[model samples]
Each structure stands twice: as structure tokens, then as C-alpha cells.
Target chain A: MTVDSRSEKTRPDRAAATRDRILDAAERLFAERGVLAVSNRQIGEAAGQGNNSVVGYHFGGRSELVLAILRRHAVAVEQLRTDLLTRVHPGSALHDWVGCLVRPLPAHLAELGDQSWHARFLAQASNEPTLRAVIRADAKASPSLRRAQEGMFRLLPAVPAEVRAERGEMSRLVVVHMCAEYERALQNGVAPPSRTWETAAARLVDAVVGLWLAPVTPAVLGPDAALRCRR
Target chain B: MTVDSRSEKTRPDRAAATRDRILDAAERLFAERGVLAVSNRQIGEAAGQGNNSVVGYHFGGRSELVLAILRRHAVAVEQLRTDLLTRVHPGSALHDWVGCLVRPLPAHLAELGDQSWHARFLAQASNEPTLRAVIRADAKASPSLRRAQEGMFRLLPAVPAEVRAERGEMSRLVVVHMCAEYERALQNGVAPPSRTWETAAARLVDAVVGLWLAPVTPAVLGPDAALRCRR
Candidate 1:
């Protein structure tokens, strides 16, 4: 009765807080165990919810739950990219824009400090067809990401659409899996090849920039390739 | 008495055949579902074994089962890599040596024709930390892979060890994930980015070669990287 008289706006903030707690617990468990292995009941318990079904109630299912986690990070990651965009000049080198693409992730993870699992969680999701779609769709919504991509592409040679798409996929694989491996390595007391997250990001930036700058070789189109996309 | 003699000699062959059937079913199911989602009983039934426990009886558990699947493919892929090495002279270009590393995979998949699950199975395994170790250990055992690594390394710039290791990981992620995507795409009637298997392999080779050739950025080694190796 007293709550009914209070501001309804405060309720939304409480709901948001509950949502954050569920996502946090879900990401950590999913990262430590396999994604499919951890159940929503476990997530609810970890989130300190009394009801075991709270994760499902709040997020619907695993896919939505996963998306919520991706989205929670996407906003912050996009913000980092947006902040970095302010430093970019019109004629910056390809590597500079590339840095804009790669740096935001590690920088954000560093901000998360020791308890980071987003990168590992993401890497695990990348291998699953459905989960990977959620990530791709979320990434496609980033205005700053699209800007960095266009800026980088403008500096490179006009690659065939197929090659362009292929490289883009490669870029994703490298970033997610490398970070996953590095994060896992640090957690296991096995030293990561690159010392700091900053240096790891640096190495990743250099390799990715190189990937973009590499020349494309004309493939001898077999019947299938020719049928799919004739030059 | 005659039946006893025949059963003893043929028992080994029958067990071998059952192992092959189990591997085939396990790979197919694992590729279609996920590594953790499928059960040993389902695998046994799929393999046509009447005994529900035959999968566990034959292969021990999921890790061993996954390893058996990997080992089955490793020999043929390694053989192809070995065959390719004859053409790689000491002065071969970095791209040529890179071919030795990348081509064997798609080439082997093409050999399997329409029904191949190795790539997808590998992609799924890559998500699970334990399963991935089995794949990595199997790859490590191949003499040709070692030779290819050494050969590729010789043609490239002397990158810092951490950077070199980092890029090597990047190379693996791009190869496995892209091939997995391509395989799944082909299976589902979704046109792959590069149409044919050969063309897809060609694009991958070109990109990885570029990655290896990318200039190494000097790392600002934090204490961990510095301790691992000094410049």
C-alpha cells in the first residue's frame, strides 16, 4: 500500500538492478563452465534471487539471456569506440582507425578489472550458430563501429565482396578467440603471451591492420564460385 | 569348436568396425547438436548398436570420444600436409609455406565430398576448453604440422616471441571459425562467402599469409610479458 503511493519511476531502477545482477551471474558461470552446461536455476541462485525461475522470468530464455548480456556490454563498448572516434583525424592512417576498432574491447575489459568474463563468454558464443547471430546483430547496430569500418575500408584497395566478407569474419574470429585464450591463460596461472591487456590489444591491432593491408590473390573460380558470384 | 576359432580372429575386426561406426555417429551428432548437448546412449543408437552403453564401453567418455574423432581425421590431414611438403623448397615464398599450413584442411574436407563434419566438429570442440585441448594435442603430434610451422617461421620477420605466438593463435581462430561457417553455410543452403571449397581455401590462405606478413608492432611489455621473455 505504501509502495503504491511512492514514485513508479523507482520501480524501473530496481528492475534494472535485478537485470544487471542476473546478467553478471550468468556471464561468470557461462564463462567458467560451458554455456549449455550452466542452467538458469544456477544463474538465479548465483544472482541471489530466491526463486530459481527468476532468470527465465526476467530474460525469457537462454538466447534472450545471452542477448541481454551482449547488450549490457555493447553499450559500454560502443561508448568507448565513440570516445576514441573523437581523437581520429580525417586523414589518419589505416592502423589508426583499426586501433579504434580493436582498442575499445581491451580498454573496456581492463575497466572491468579482474572479474572480466565478457570476452570468454563472447568467444564461447561465437562457436554456436544461433548465439553468434545475437552477437552479430548487436554489433551491426553500433553507429561508431560502422563508422570505423567504413573509415578503414576507404583506405584499403577495393576488395571483392566475397573477400571483404571473408576478412571481416576473420577479424571477428581473431579478436574473440585471442582474447578468450588470453583471459583463460591469465586465470589459470599460465602466463598470457602478451603481458598486459594493453599489450595484447596492441599486438591484436598490429595483426589485424596487417590482415587488412594484405593483397588479395585472384582465386581460380570453380563452378560453384562462378555460379554463386560471377565476376 | 570351429566357431570359437573364427570368433577369436574376427572379434578384433568387429570391435574396430563398431569403433568406426561410433565415431561417425558421434561426429555427426556433435556437429549437428553441440558437444555437451548429446549423450553417449544417443550416439550408440545412432551408430546402430543395440546396447545403449556401447558408446561409453567403446570410447570411455566424451573427451576420449572427441579425441577418437579428431584422431580419425588427423592422419588423413597430416598425410595431405606431408604430401604437400615435397613441393615446398627452402626458398619457397612465405605464402607458399602458408599454403602448407592452410590448404590441407579444406583439401581434406573436399575429399570427404558432401558429407563432412570434421570442420564443424572442430569448431564446436574449440568452444569447450577440454575438447579443444584434445584437438590441439593431436595437431601438435603431427610431424608435418611442425615442419610447416618451422618452415613458415623461417621465411617471416623475426617477430617478438609473444607477438609470433599471438599471431599463430589468430591464424588458428580464423582458419577454424571461417571453415566452420563455410561448412555450416554449405550444409544449410546458405551460400558461403567464397562459393567453392577451393575458392574459400584460397581466400583463407591469402588472408593468413597477410597476417603472417604484417609488421610487428613493438610491444610495451608489462611485467608479465617481460617476465615471460625479455626483448
Candidate 2:
């Protein structure tokens, strides 16, 4: 019933480092092999630990390890959300908001941000059921995420609670798809005709913005209105 | 290297029950564990085939097995889409299209549709990378899907290619969120508050459609006036 003394014996600084290493290794492997395919032993080995005990020692188990990885990165992810909200003007084009949301990752990768791998891994985890709960829980618990949501709620006063939740879900998906696709593009070395990472980011932002900003006008309801006929 | 005799042995009459068994097991497992996590042997065993070769003999392999499940439920899925599209009156509401796309799974389950599990599995696969390609390839090969796409293209003629693609991606994420939430709800046996599912679906569709159908009344801006918003 007591906390594991074996885990507590390690110095706090060293323990933190080991935990980071395990998380780093785990995210990379999860990104490459998926949550189910990656084993605790493999994660420990990747972290330079001698045995599978690290997974249990540092975290309770594989599931907990996944949560830790997500928890660690939830800060950066939430900050990205805040950054977008800050950039939106009351009258700004909807796409501008979309651009603000979509443009960050490649921009970071180009600048060589420390958490690029973690970002990519988190994006992948967004869809994974075994790992998705961890990501959602971490995201929900993030102060930055809370602040961002609050800001969005303030900006979208007219949007219903249910609508806000739905919009939030779409926002998450847009980020996941953009990040995952960007990573795949890098892996394939297919420099999208855009030429620069920033350019690629801009294109993504444009496409996202166009989709989000394009349909805000009130529609005259009719049998075929759902089909989105041209104005 | 050679085509297996099993392929020849799978005449339409003998294959119906076997194919259904394969699909039922594959869809359930894929929903529980992704395509990579569910092995051929596991699928064969679950399908009640004595030999592990049933997956290959019946559906090619793991990837093909995933595609087979998609194809098996293609009719039901498409019917759902058509039903939703038809529900939108001339202009009754465009935002409902988003709900139409997402709400039907729960409705299908409520109605005791035969392929509800497969729909849930496909919803999960929509967010997965390994299965995305398989599903996309199958969609490309499916005449019904192409016909549906053409039908949509004709209706939304003003939607740019890139915009269409982005919306499609966004739609996938919407489905993923709904499916993931539904799965958790089912696991917990919690019925979301009445109107919760429909409300959530409507809210998401509003954001998606709002951004796409933004009402910019193009005032007969002499070319110069029209150019004002270009930047």
C-alpha cells in the first residue's frame, strides 16, 4: 500500500531525467509502432534502462507511460491554442484564425523546436483509443488549454455550449491532421511545391482558413441549402 | 507468387457466410484494436476458422482484411450519407449536413441496424494513419463512393479542390471525435443526456459549415472594390 521506496530512492534530479528519457523514447516508439505494438521492454531499452521495470518504476505501467508523454506535451499544445486565439481580431477573416491555428508546427520544426518529436507523437496519439484518453485528460487538465477555451468561449459568446465543444473537437482534429501530414511529408522528403517550411505552413493555414472562414454567411434555408450552392 | 487455390474456391455461394464471419470479427477487433494490433491469426481464430490462413485465403491479408470490412459495410454507410443529404431541404439548413454526417451511427445503433459495428469500426479507422490509406484506396475503388463524390461535387460546384479536401479531412476528424466519445459512452454504459449527441453534432457542423459558407455578400464591387478584401 505504501509508495515504492525503490522508486523514491533515486535522486529527484536524476529521476526526472530518467523519466524524461523514458517519455522521449516512448513517444518516438509510439509514433513509429503505435501504442499497442510498442512494448514496455522496448521502451526501457530505448531509454537506456536495463529492464522493463523502468516503465513500472517511473510510471505505473504502459498506459500511465502514455499519459505522462501526453501530459508532458499538453503544455506546448495548449500554448499553441492560446497563440491562435490571441491573433484573432473581432472582425478578422475566419481563415485568419484558422491560419493562426495551423501555422505553428512546421514553423517550429524549421526553427528546430525541442518538442518536435513530442508534438508529432501527440498528434498521432489524438486518434489512438488506447492512448487517446490520456491525451484528452491531459489536455483537459492543462491551464493553458483552460485559458484558451475560456478565451474561445468569450470570443464566441453566441455559440452554444454544445457548439463550442464541437468546434473544439474540430480544432483538435485540424491540428492532428496538419501535424501528421506535415510529418509524413517530411519523412517522404516530398518538399511540397511550396519550397520552404514557412511556405508549407502558409499553404496549410490558407487551406484551413478557407474552409473555416468561407461558410460564415447566413444561408436562406431551402430543400437544397445543405448542399452549399455557390453565392 | 501464384494466386492461391482458395481464391478459386471462394465461389459466391460458399463465400457469403465465410465473408460475413470474417467481416464481423475483423470489424469488432479493428474497433477494439487498430488494424496493426489485430493479427491475421487472431482474426481467423475469432472468425472460427480452424486454420490461421483464413484471413489470407478469404481477404488477402491484414490490410486487405481492413478494406474488406469497409467494402462490406459500404452500402449501409452510403445509404446513411444519401439519407442525410436528402434531409436538407432547399435551404432548410446547411449546418445540419454536418450532423447528418455524424449523428447516424448512434441512430443506426438505436435502430438495430445489422452493420452498426462495422460503421463504428470505420469511424475509428477514419482517424488512423495505417487504416486511412487502406480506406482511401478502397473509396477510390468504390463506384458508389465515386458516385457520391460526384453528386456532392455537382451540388457544391463553388467549393475549390483544396477546400473540398480540407473539409473532407475535417469531416473525418469530426467522425473520429464522435466515434471515440461514443465508444467511451458505450463502455461506461452512459447514455449521454437526451439531445446531447444531436446537439453536439449540430454544433460541430455549424462551425464546419459556418467557416465554409461564410456569407460574404459580394456587393457588386467594381473589380477594384472587390480587390479590397484580397489581402
Compare the candidates by lDDT and give the number of the best one: 1
Per-residue accuracy of model 1 over B26-94 as CA lDDT, tens digit each? 999888766886889889989999998898888897899998898888878888888878888889888
lDDT of each: 0.82, 0.59
Root-mean-square deviation of each candidate, in angstroms? 4.3, 8.5
Clashes of 2: 27
The local lDDT score (0 to 100) that residue B168 gets in candidate 1 is 81
Candidate 2 second chain TM: 0.67
Off by over 4 Å in 2: A1-20, A71-110, A113-116, A128-130, A195-231, B1-15, B80-115, B127-130, B142-160, B183-187, B196-205, B214-231
What tens digits encode model 2's per-residue C-alpha lDDT throughout B134-210?
87776677554454445444445375454466556666665555655655565556634443333334444555554
- Clash numbers, per candidate: 0, 27
Per-residue lDDT of model 2, residues A1-231, tens digit only: 899887788778788999899888988887765576677888899999997688888898766877887667455545555566675665665445554455445544544433356545766566566576766776677664565344434444364444445455666666666666666666667634433444445545544443433333232345543332211
Q: Any residue pairs clashing in model 1, and if so which? A: none
Q: What DockQ, on C-alphas, does every prediction get?
A: 0.45, 0.16
Q: What is the lDDT of residue B111 in candidate 2?
A: 40
